[model samples]
Target: MTHAQTQESNHLQRGLKVEQKKILDTLLQSVYRQEGWVFFVYGSGGIGKTYLWRALISKLRSENHIVLAVASSGIASLLLPGGRTTHSRFKIPFALNEYSCCNIDQGSDLAHLIEKASLIIWDEAPTAHRHAFEAVDRTFRDIMQLRHPTSMEKVFGGKVVVLGGDFGQILPVVKKVGRADVIDASISKSLTIWPHCTVFKLETNMRLLQRDGKLPAIAKEGEDEPMWINIPDDLLIKAREDSIDEMVESVYLDLLQEYTNPTYLQQRAILTSKYDMVDKINDHILKMIPGGEKVYKRADRVCPITKTGVNVEALCPTEFLNTLQLPGIPNRELKLKVGCP
Candidate 1:
C-alpha cells in the first residue's frame, strides 16, 4: 500500500457507525469460520457504504486474508484498497445473457486468485447486469474445487461474497432495450442469485448525520409509520406555466453568482434527463462566463482494429458511427475544457 492508502485506512478506522460495525462483525465471523455466506448491503447515497468498505478492507488485510475488491465504475474502484472493475477482474462477457460464465481458464492465475481469496467485496453491484454476477458464480464453481465433490453446491464455492450498492441510482444499462428489459437486468430481480443471498438494509444516512448530527427518530415497528427526511416545502415546484423557469430560478437564486466567486462553480451543477437539455443548459451557462467561447475544435473518428483474423472496420463505417447521438458520449466532436466550453 502507498502512504496515501495507509492514511485513508487509518482515517476510516476512527468514528465507525453502528450499522457499519454490525456488517463488519458479520463479515469477520464468516471469514473466520470459512462458511459460504452471500450478503447484499442495500443503501442509498451518503449512507457510508464506501466508509464501511474501507474499514472492512483495512481489518481483513491486517488478519492476512485474501480479499478481492471490485466495483462497477473506475471512480468507485479507486476508493477501495487495490480495487479493480468487475468486468476486468472476472472476465465477464461483453454481450451477457442468462447463461453466461466468466472466461477464466482453468489453472490460470485468475483462477488461482479466486481459489486463494477468503472473501469477495463487490461495490456498485446494482449498476451491473445480474448475468455478470451469475457468470462470476459459475466461474468460481468451475475453477474452485473444494474438499468435497458437493462443494459446488455451496454459493461461490464456500467463499463469502458481499455486494453493496444503491438500487435507486442508475441501474444496469440495457442498450436499445425496454424498461422491462432494463429492470430484468438488475441483480435484485434475479431469481437465481437474489433468492439465496441475504440482504441487509442501511437506512440511516450517515453522511447527513455527520453533517447535521441529528435525524428524525423512526417509530417502533407496528406502532407507527417509519420516518422520512422532510424536504423543504419552499423548494417544491408546482405545475404552472413557468414551472421550469421557476425551477431554474429557484435552483440558482443568483444566476451569475459564480461570475464574482469563480470557485462557486465547482459546488453547483445542472442535472437533466435529456442530453439536449444538458447541452443547451451548459452552452447557455458557458455563454455567461464573460466572453466564454468554443475556441477548440477536433475531429473524432471510430477507427476499428483487426481482432483475431477479422477486420473490425468492415462491419461498421466511421461516417455512420459519427452520426450516433449516444448518451454520455458527444457525437463526433471533442467539446469543452476545464472552466471552458
Candidate 2:
C-alpha cells in the first residue's frame, strides 16, 4: 500500500471528529492524489496543523510509501515523532553562496534516499526560503538525471509536497514566501507565467469562540480580511476594573482579622488605587507579616528603636514591624522592632 493509503486507514481507525475527518478526506481526495502538486494549508494557530500532519503521515506510512515530515519549530518534538528538518530532509546546504548549485552530490546516500521518497510534508513552510525550495526541486531533477517534462513526469519527480503554516505568525528569516511578499517582489512576478499551484485556505477556526456561539469568522479566501479581533476600548476598561475589584476584595478578606489598625486599613485602601500599587502594598504587608503566621499583628506590637553608633538593637519584642528611615534625624534610623524574629 502507498503511504497515503496507510495514513487514511489509520485515521479511519482512530475515528476523528467531523471537521477533522472532512479535512483529511479533502486532503486525500483533492491534494494527495495530484502529482507535481504543491498543497498549502494556511490556518490560524491552534487550529490543528500538527494533528492533521500526524494523521497524514500515519495514512501515508500504512500505504507503504515514504513519508518525510519536517517542522520549523519544535525540532525535538518532531524528532520524537520520527520527522526531520525540511533543509536536512531536502539535503539543502545552510549557506546559499555563488558556488551553491541545485544538484546533489553523486554517490551521496542521503540524496539517493530522498530521491526514492514518496512525499515530503514541510510544517511552518512560511519560514522556508523560496530559494531553498527551488534548490531542492533542482536537486531532485538533477539526481534522477531526467529532463524537464519527462523527469518531472514520475510521482517522486512529480512528488507531492504539502506545506503547512499560519502566515499570521512569523515569516521566513532568510527569504520570505507567501502572497504579500511574492506580490511585492518584481522578480517573482516576472517568473510566474501560469499559476500551477493550488492554494487552499482553511476558513473554519476551531480555536476561538464568537459572540453568537459559533466559531470565529475567518476569511476563507481574501487578502483584505482582518485576522485579529478588534475589541472595544470601553469593554477592555470595564474588564480591567472588574478584575481589580475582585482581587482587592479577596486580599482584604484574607487580611481582615490580622491587621486591625485603622492606619493599616487606610494604607490598604490607598494601595487599591491601581494594580501596581496593590502589588507594592501586598509585598510590604507580606514582609511585615511574620513567616509561618497567616495573620498580621497591630502596630502597637512595634517598638521604636534608636540606632547607636554602628550597632542597632530592638528595644521591644513586637509582633508587627515597619522600618522607616528619616533624614536629618539622629542616627538617621527608625526601626519598628517586632516580637517575631
Candidate 3:
C-alpha cells in the first residue's frame, strides 16, 4: 500500500470526540457530494481545533481527495499537512483593496490545482484582513464556475471551505490604524462572505495542565455529569495592577530544573505591554538557558536623495522617517536598505 493508504489504515485505529466526528462527517460529506458549504471553526488558543484539522486532513487525503491546508501565519501553517500561508498558496495581493482578486488565470497550473482541490482549510483566519477573504471568494467563484457551470452562482463556486480562528484573540491587522480600524477590517464586518459562513465553537481547553499545575481530578458521579478543570488562584492574577512575578512564579518556577525539556520554552511565555519589557524577559530567559550566544547584526543604508528612480518622491525624507517609533511596527519610516540581511 502507498503512504496515503497507510495513514488511512492508522486513522481507523483511532476515534474522535462526538462533536469533532460530527463536524468531520459533515465536511467529508460536502466534499464527496460536491456541495458548496462554508464553515468557520472558532475557538480560543486551544480546544483541539488543530487536532480536528489534522484528523480531517488525514481522512480526506487517504481517500485520494485534494486538501489545501493553509494558515494566516507561517508558524501556524507548519502544523498542517502540506501547509502554506494563504497569501502564498492563493497568490493574494499584498496590498489588498475592495476589488482585489487572486492572480490565478483560468487555464494556469495554479488554477488546475484549485480546481482539483476538494476542500480548503485555513487556520487562524481572523488574523487576516477582510479583503484577503474577498479576494479568495472572487477568485474561487470565477475559477470553479468555469469548471462546472452549475456552480456559476455559488458562494465559493460550489466548493467546501473551512476557516478557523479566535475572533476574540487577534482581529485583522490594520497598519498605522487605531483599534476601530482593526475592528472594521475583521471578516465579521464583511458584507459579502461572513453572513454565508456557518460557525462552530470549541469551548474546552484540551491541553491538560502540567502535573504540578493541574487540579485534582474529580470523581464522576454520573454519565451526565460535566467534566471541568479548575485552575489555582495563585497561578491567576487578581488585580488590575499587573504582577509579572506572580505569573512567572506560577508558570516557570521549575524552569531552571526543566531547562533541558524541549517544550519548556513553548509552554511558558511572558507577555508584556512594552517591547522593551519583552527584550528584558528575552535576555533573562537566554541567560537561564545554559548556552553562550552569538549575535548577528544588520547593516542599514539610505539611498541618495537624487530623483533618478521611476516616480520617485522623497515623501518625508529618510532622516525624518527614522525617528518615529510605533507599537507593533517600527516607529520610524522603513529605510530603503541596499542589501539583504
Candidate 4:
C-alpha cells in the first residue's frame, strides 16, 4: 500500500478502545466464521459509531479479508467508481412503495457486489427503509442463489453484513424503521433464534467537553438533562434586539476607523450583517455611505418572488423585503430588488 494508506490504516487500528476491541473480536469470530450474520452497533450521536467501523475494517484488512464500507451520506465518496445513495443501492425509489418481489432484479449489481465482499459495513443504516433492507436481502439471495441448499451451503453464502448507526439521530425519512421494525422483520424471517443476528449497544460520549456540568451524562442508558432556564418571549426579543444593535454599532465604528476608501467601507459594512438583520440594516448602510454609491450595485440586485394558487394568485414579497407578517399571509409573489437602498 502507499504511504498515506499505511498511515491511515495505522491510525484506525490505534484508535480502537477496550469495548470496541471486544465488539470487533466478537464480530470477527461470529460473522466471519458463521453464515448470515447481521450485526448492528447502535448509539447516540457523536459517540464514535463511524470510528469503530473504520477500526474494524482496518483490522479486517490487516487479516487479509476483503471489506467494503458504505454510508448514506458519502455514497459517492464511499462506493468504488462512484458512491450511490441508499435508495440507489437498494434500487428503491425516493418515495416508499409496497414491497414486491418483482423489484429484486433491479438490485442485481449490488447483490453481486455484496456476494463477493467478505465484510459489508453499512454506516448510517438507521435512515434506510425497512422494505429496502428486505429487498436487498431477497435480491442477493436470488442473484447468488445462496438461498438454495444446493449452492455452496458451507461457504456462508455471501458477505457478512454489519450495520452501524444512531437510531436517535433520525429514523428513515421515506419509511420509519425502529427497534420494533427490526424485531418484526427478524421474527418474520424465522431467523429470530439465530445467534448470528444481534444488536450491540455502544454507550459513551467521547466527543463532548466534560468540563461543562450541563453536559449529559455519558452512559448507555439514562434520563436526558433537564432545561434550567426559561425566559418569556417579550424579554427574549428585546435582549436579541439590543445585542444586534450593539454589534451593528461596533461594526460601523470599526469600518469608519479602518477603511480609507468608500469601496472598503462598503465591503466592511456588508460583512457586518452577522450582528444584525442583513437585509434591513445593510440597506440602511448602503444608502447612508458616502458618494451615494450603494454597497451592492444596482445590477447586482436580483428579485426572487413566486406566485401561488391557480385562480386567486396574489403577489408576496420575498424574504429580503418582508420582515414581519401581520396575519393570514396570502400566497402571492412580488418582485423586489436585493441590496436596495
Q: Lowest-lDDT window of 10 residues in candidate 1?
A: 291-300
Rank order by lDDT, top first? 1, 3, 2, 4
What candidate 2 gets wrong by more than 4 Å, as runs, is 1-23, 29-34, 74-80, 97-103, 146-149, 152-156, 174-194, 209-341
- lDDT by residue (tens digit), candidate 2, 96-160: 54234454575587666665666677778666555555556656656655434565443235666
lDDT for every model?
0.78, 0.56, 0.77, 0.55
User: Best candidate, TM-score-wise?
Assistant: 3
**Model 4 misplaced stretches (Cα beyond 4 Å):** 1-4, 30-34, 61-64, 73-84, 95-98, 101-110, 146-158, 174-196, 209-341
Instruction: Give the clash count for each candidate.
Output: 0, 16, 5, 6
Q: What would the per-residue lDDT of candidate 3 be over residues 1-341, giving only the tens digit for each residue?
A: 37867666367426566677777788888889988888998877767788889888888777788999999999999989799999899999999999999999998999989899999999999999999999998889899887688666777777889999998788886789999889989898888889989998776666642332346655466656557666776556664454555555566878767756767766666677887676555555555555445554333235645576643235655555555455765433222222211
lDDT of 4 by residue, 237-286 (tens): 34354354555565567543444556556554434434335445654544
List ranges where model 3 is wrong by over 4 Å: 1-15, 176-178, 208-341
lDDT of model 1, residue 93: 91
Better of 1 and 4 by TM-score: 1
Taking all chains together, each candidate's TM-score versus the true structure is 0.64, 0.51, 0.65, 0.55
- TM-score of candidate 2 on Cα atoms, chains taken together: 0.51
Worst-scoring 10-residue span by lDDT in model 3: 332-341
- lDDT of residue 184 for candidate 3: 85
Distance from true position, residue 331, model 4, in Å?
Answer: 18
